[model samples]
Target: MTSNSTTYEGGCTCRQVRYRMTAKPLFVHCCHCRWCQRETGTAFALNAMIEADRVELLSGEPEPVMTPSASGRGQKIWRCPTCRIAVWSNYGSAGDAVRFVRVGSLDEPDRLPPDIHIFTSSKQPWVVLPEGAPAVTEYYDTKKTWPAESLARREALRAKRS
Candidate 1:
């Protein structure tokens, strides 16, 4: 979704898991893998990939579930206990350094639509991708192709770190 500002707010079904994203997403992706299908109980998973530092929890905490990773380690997944809605996840390898928020849980549900699809090899045969949408058999990092505005924000952050 297009907006004048980068910030967006979201919460769980019961509104008990409010959160604020302080910046625009670095990238958006649609995951068609079986794992995502089963987890979301949908055809695909839409994610607004953002900097972990830009996400803030503004309400109640979510219950944590640690699921084993593809490499056998565990990753912490946070969800709303009442709705069992997956709110966010702390990717295992980085040990809670980065997170992937479930864009469906956002208050502005229409704000971020997937511009690309990941794990297309596992997509259901009946599901057709949109014309001109980029698809990949596996994951693609966004750093190489972030939109101009987001790239500038990332560079500014990097400069601050240095």
Candidate 2:
């Protein structure tokens, strides 16, 4: 919305759902939590945290499927009806205002690397975090980890949330 040029386009595996991130994300998270590993069937889940309003739908709509989370607060996973591939999710804390876009679903996932690695305590033994990459045993306080610009963006989004 602020004349951002870094846009990312992506979609589901079946191409049933297409979307574009209008601006850079607030922050990216590479979660190694057990829930993430189980849900993604992989070692981790890379998510680009962004304001929901910044995500523009380009094609089909994604159906929101309510799913259980480790916090027991539940999460709404938005997936393509045709492929059933999750594109993003709305967590209970963020409500429907924020979206955790699956980085793997992006057309150029490598363009947005994880800003931080979370829940590393549950990370797979075979996966060794890069030397210098920010890794935390659990979640982190955004005030301490995120950049000032990102924190400001988050604050703006927070005002918009109901």
Candidate 3:
């Protein structure tokens, strides 16, 4: 992690599932997919994509909730059983090893902002995406996707900017 890159500390509602991410996020996003809406019990879900290795579990283990994805894949949502708050999710494919952390569940939720708005086609009409954000009407994207090297580069850039 770069010096200027912020270290984020967060946990579930009851603080039973604490976590720390040493590096800056790969990307932040507001997803408006139907699954997100049902799962989050909100119009959308705020997510911070980060390298799996950089995230450390500081406390209790999260209970897993398995659900089907839009692509017919399985998604395992990890949550704090005490608070029943979804903290992170793992995509089913063995080839993909990243976990999507729920940004809102963090201790410092404001450390990051949604840089992109995804699944806009399912977005609620009343909710307008912030101006200048990258918006997509469908599933799967590249602009907000993070590769390891790119993530490291972004961390460096963040340090320089800070």
RMSD of model 2 against the true structure:
2.5
| lDDT of the structure predicted as candidate 2 | 0.92
Best by TM-score: 2
lDDT of 2 by residue, 77-136 (tens): 999999999999999988888999999999888889999999999999999888999999
Off by over 4 Å in 1: 1-4, 141-143, 147-162
Question: What are the clashing pairs of model 1?
Answer: 10-107
> Candidate 1, residues 1-162: lDDT per residue as tens digits?
225477888878888888888877877778897777877789988877676788898988889997765656766778987887788876665455456778888877787888789999999999998888888898776675567886777677566656
Lowest-scoring 10 consecutive residues by lDDT in candidate 1? 90-99
Candidate 1 C-alpha error for residue 130, in Å: 0.9
lDDT (C-alpha) at residue 148 in model 2:
95
Residues 1-162, model 3: lDDT tens digits: 123447888888788889888777777778999988988889998988765777899999989888888778888888898988888887765212466889987777877888778899999999977787778897555534656665676566456555
Q: Estimate each model's TM-score.
A: 0.82, 0.95, 0.82
For model 2, give the 10-residue run with minimal summed lDDT.
1-10
